[model samples]
Target chain A: MLTEKRNWGWHVLLILIVMAIMLPVLFMISNSFKTLQESYHAILQLIPAKPTFSNYLTLNKQINLLRMVSNTFLMAMIVTLGKVATGLLAAYAFQNFHFKGKRLVYFIFVATIFVPFTTVMIPNYLVIAKMNLLNNVIGVALPQMADATGIMLFIKAMGKIPASLTESAKVDGIPNRKIFMNLIIPLLKPSIISVGAIFFINSWNEYVWPTLVLKDKSSFTLPLALQNYISSEGGTNFPLAMALAVIMIVPPLLIYMIFQRYILNSISTSGLK
Target chain B: MLNNNSQIEEAVNSRYGPRASRKPRRRLLPFLYLLPSALLLLVFMIIPIGYTFYLSFFNWNLIAPTKEFVGLANYVNVFTDPTNQKVILNTLVYIVLLVILNFILPYFISLIVNFFIGKMKGPYKILFFIPSLFSLVVGAMLFSWILNPVSGPLALFLRDFGMKVPQWTNSGAMAIVVICLITNWKVFGYNFILLLTGLGAVPKNILDAAALDGVPKWRVIWNIVLPLNRGVAIYVFILTIVQGLQYVFTPINVITQGGPYYGSSNLLYHTYLNAFVLYKTGNASALATVTFVIFLILLFIEIKFVEGRHKDAD
Candidate 1:
């Protein structure tokens, strides 16, 4: 009897915990279906009595929703591709090649992680302005192109690649560049894919830097666009804003699901190790 | 094993006309690989830190561009001012509460989830992890409604029970605490996922051995699982500390706007306000330096502890 009660208690707590975790998301989805009048009503209703697509339709027409989605997608892809290419190259060098200042350079790069974005935001803005890159997708992509996290992941992934393969390639008169291109890159495919997914998601969701740099409405990323919409036009229109939220969330969610197998593998390995 | 010069020399001679011709190339490849990141660090990362230090020493303002060096003036003002001190204290309290909740809540959630792992874990993990995938603006906005004093779910429940629903965001102190709760709630799934991975890394044989020795399941968790997953604990703590500092900006900006009065103002948002809004670049730089130093010390301590324990275990 006592054991049964304990089991029941555990199951109840687990369900409650899961509910607590999911309640907000469920509420947001439900609210998206709610009418403005219904949402603003004093009573909280789990189910919307009058479901409508007006909020969603308004979201599509009023906000440049598709443009923001494409803009975010393009920028994230550019940044992800740049990081993978550069990160893989650097990691291959560190793993297979030995030279002076290797440890020092690696340490310097790792140390970059400590310097918070706020410290660099002012100067980064200045640098971007000097390059005439402000209000451009390239501006958003440049700083993220060589992230330390990708480099670290690549280095760790490449380290796990056996040295025998590189030695064998060298014995066959393979050039250093060729070895990196043909051998190291292939071996690090999983790492590249995983890091690319993470980088893409991060870039897609990035807000502050874009908020600071991009002043053009046409060039606005999804998060920035949604934020602007919420603060300005969508204020007090919780249903419409929730619809916008749903729209902003869908692409990343789709991308996440597509690459979920790699993501889970990478996350489990990266987190545990 | 070419852990020495001979293999490199042989490769050098084979690659180029001679060993002498190859020397510079060998010396150059590593630097060449690092050049882009190093230059980026110099221009964007390192110089910015130096510029922050320089700005802190001057009476720099965005509005008034007459930069005058004030030596230790901003630093002195930041340290000596009561309001600045309160912000620092509040930031520390916020971080401590965040670290505690982020570390503990997720650990148990992972523990509970591990009980029913095989069939439903994938969907369960995704369900739990989805909240973290939302942007801070959305999360904060959603929670703001959830915590609304009048018509929110909580308030409505209280109203039916004939109890007054306290306005959480109206008061400064409670506002900060509620922000921390919301922050923790949003992030708990991420840590839970991480902890589950750590728990999965524990060898099954060790648990089996403990069970055969008649050790209770609780003891097995305490003695075997917890000790082995120390790395996850360290990682979680370090990440929580850094994220905790960075995230104070979101709550400060969105929920309170740094207060009913500057009550919930943590260091980062305060620095931002000083830099852009109020145009006290000097004060902002000084504040950034102090916060950076505090973070560096904490990171150093965490590294030392982890390394010491690791070495002892090995």
Candidate 2:
């Protein structure tokens, strides 16, 4: 009887934490369709009386949601491709080749992990301005592609591949570039997907860099556009803003839901230690 | 490749032989492949860090033709300024509170969840981890609408019960504190999943032994479970601290803008405002330098304290 009671206690605690985590999301989704007056009614209910799609319609018309979505998708796709290609090449080099200043150079890259991006915001802005890439997707993607963490992660994953694979390839008269592309790259797909998922989410969510660099409203990502829309209207359009918020969150959430199995498998095995 | 005859010739003639001689070149390719990463670190990371350090000593602005060095005057002024001092205290308090609450809460939650391994666990983990999938920018925007004191869901819910809901983002210090708390929620799932993975690694036999020995449930948790999971605890600690720095960005930038009255700026956001908003590149650089030093000190402590334990355990 005592053990039964204790089990119930743990179950109750679990339920409460789950509730705490889910409460905001539940509230957001529920209020998405509620009328403004009903939304502001004195009771916090999880259901709406008259659920409508007008807020969603209003958000689409006002925010240019489609263009922003396409821009974000295009940029995320480019960043993912660049990160996977360059990141894999870098990792293969670290794992397969022996060179001078190798350990020292890699450590230098790792050491900068703590160097906050704000430190480089001014310098990067200047560089982007000089390159005449402002308001361009390339400018947005390039800065993000300069990712040390992705390179480091890929290198660590590559290091685990048996050295004999490379030796056997070399014996077969395979060139280094061909070996990396044809042999090594296929084996490291899981690592690529795992790291790629993280990078995709990050680039999609990025605001400050994009905000500062991209001056054109049409080029703005969802977050920036939504922020500007809300602030300009003095935040009065609660229903529309909430609707836009739902839209802004959907893409990354969709990607995550689809790829979550891969993410979990890779992370559990990677020894994030 | 070397000729077949040379392999036999070299094998007989040399101490290291053909294979040993080829080892360095093989290792060398890995480093060459890493060259682009090296250049990026040098250009983007290392040089910028050094520049920030240099800038901190001067009253540098983008518009200024000449930068005048002011030694440690900026640091002294920041430390002495009542407003700046309060911001630092508030930032530290928030970080400490988050580290304590976020780390232990997830560990215990994972501890309980790990006992259920099949159908129940999969859906439960997904449920808990889903919200973390949303980007911080979107999550912040969503919450801003929910927390609006006048027209937000929270305010409306309060008014129905005939209680006045406090203005969370507008009224005094509580606004900044509440915003920080909201930011903490977004990262909570990521930390929980990480802890769940760590807890999953513990040997079930040992736990079974504890149970067989008639050990009390709380005792099993305290003595058997917690110590074994020290590794995850350390990992969660380090990652949480790092995430804490970036988390302040959304709250400071969107909801508060470091305001009702400069009431919410932290070291990183203050540096951002200086560099971007004020265009005071030099002072901002100085501020970045300060933040970098603080990060270094904390990182060193984490390495020495947490990572050192892992090394010792291994």
Candidate 3:
């Protein structure tokens, strides 16, 4: 039940709170439409009186926005696919198999979750450079292929699947492969979406690794493109930077807005699990 | 009826046709399934840690063809460096600031929305969550442009009220605070949602019964809600300490570059600077080793705590 003292004061207070959080975002969206000259002339203007697409055009001129955006999206998709596939298989193996060294293998995989990427980042960079893939999107995505948290999540989701369901299928003369295909995979469908969406967003928003790997403007991820020439700036660059940031931010925001329940629920569930 | 385990076992055993005759078929199957992830872990994570430690003992700029045997020199320098000392101190400061901004403040914010205000909770949550969806880089850039200390929108906005905004980059302490706020904005709502879920999971009946007994709200929240939500609260706590430093890395790079005499730099950003900016691979490796050890200790404690809980449930 709702609180008894839900007075008019509460609604007003809530709206004010919402606006405080939202105004900066509104500020970002509004400024993305401004021209460089207008942006410089009125830095405090939330809404550009004469909005123009010139900033976005300059963004493309300065950096290959189309190419970078596509590359970033492709990188996200590849990493997400790799994580889900590897994590699913690994989780399934741990759930069903009586193999020797199972606990040790599981421990090794899960322990990597605690291994912050910063520590191993240098060596990983060296290896990638050695592979001559410094500016490659695959190089950026390669080391991030196996997400330990995703494996752990899948394992937890799988553990919740009743063992008797698999056993019943076995007694009914269903083959092991068929049982896995029809029963196990279907039951894991919800978790698959949860992990997949999480992985996609994470990979999409990833910056540090890509910053290290993707050096060329053409190969730059969205984050890289936004930050590429930020330091050495003139009047034109800030508006262009704002345009790139707006482009970079929209998809993830849309993803969050549409599938927030899945994203948020998965986080709470995975954190506790 | 539930004790039909023996019969089910018999059926499974017999269905495979004589357990004694059964062999470990496809014994390598599970290994095959686990291969892709294991190899990635070995090459990417396990080997790199060992490699970083090995590099710490050598003096070599990344491009230099030769590496001199400088045993313990990098470690000594990393330990003795005044800038590193400040950064080490800055890390603790980061943890305190981050926990307050990202963890504790969000706890009360959620508490108000869930228990106090009680209206438009869903809409409020979605709006709050909006900031978290954007990349930390975007957030840092946005804040950097807005809070540029001169001619930025915020400075201009405040000028109308005869107020002056601090040039945050000029002071180390202020820079750290500003960067933390950038992180807090991006992370606050996500933590809010996680914590609110935890707070909401406290059984409503318990609170209702306490209300009937005329038990004060603080007593119920203090004695009851906090304990029930302890697991999640701890989860967010560890997350803040572990991931918070990383989140600040973007802003630190974009805004300050660990500037104003390295005031805003943490160990992670410092390590990045030493390795990439200065190409002091040895020093960075040593620093990275130190970071690895601290986090490992935390992870082990977590493993022990979680294992104990699982044992209790079993």
RMSD of 1: 4.6
Best by TM-score: 3
Clashing pairs in 1: none
lDDT of 2 at B204: 86
- Segments of candidate 3 deviating more than 4 angstroms: A1-3, A6-14, A40-47, A172-176, A232-236, B1-22, B304-314
Interface RMSD of each: 3.0, 2.9, 2.2
The better-scoring model by TM-score among 1 and 3 is: 3
Q: What is the TM-score of chain B alone in each candidate?
A: 0.87, 0.85, 0.87
lDDT of 3 at A74: 95
* TM of each candidate vs. truth: 0.90, 0.88, 0.91
Residue A174 displacement (Å), model 2 = 2.9
| Ranking of all candidate structures by their TM-score, best first | 3, 1, 2
Better of 2 and 3 by DockQ: 3
lDDT tens per residue, model 3, B1-314:
22373365467678776544224534766876788888888889999999999999998888899988899999898779899999999989999999999999888877777777655688877788888778888887777777766657888789889998886778999989989999998888888888888777778999899988988777888898887777677777777888898889988887788978988899999999998999999999999999889888877777766565456445
lDDT of each: 0.74, 0.71, 0.81
Highest DockQ against the true fold, candidate: 3
In candidate 1 chain A, what residue range of length 10 has the lowest lDDT sum? A228-237
Per-residue CA lDDT of model 2 for A174-269, tens digit only, reads 657668877887888877887888778778877767877888999887777766645512455666666777876777687777888877655554
Off by over 4 Å in 2: A1-5, A34-38, A41-50, A232-234, A269-271, B1-28, B115-119, B305-310
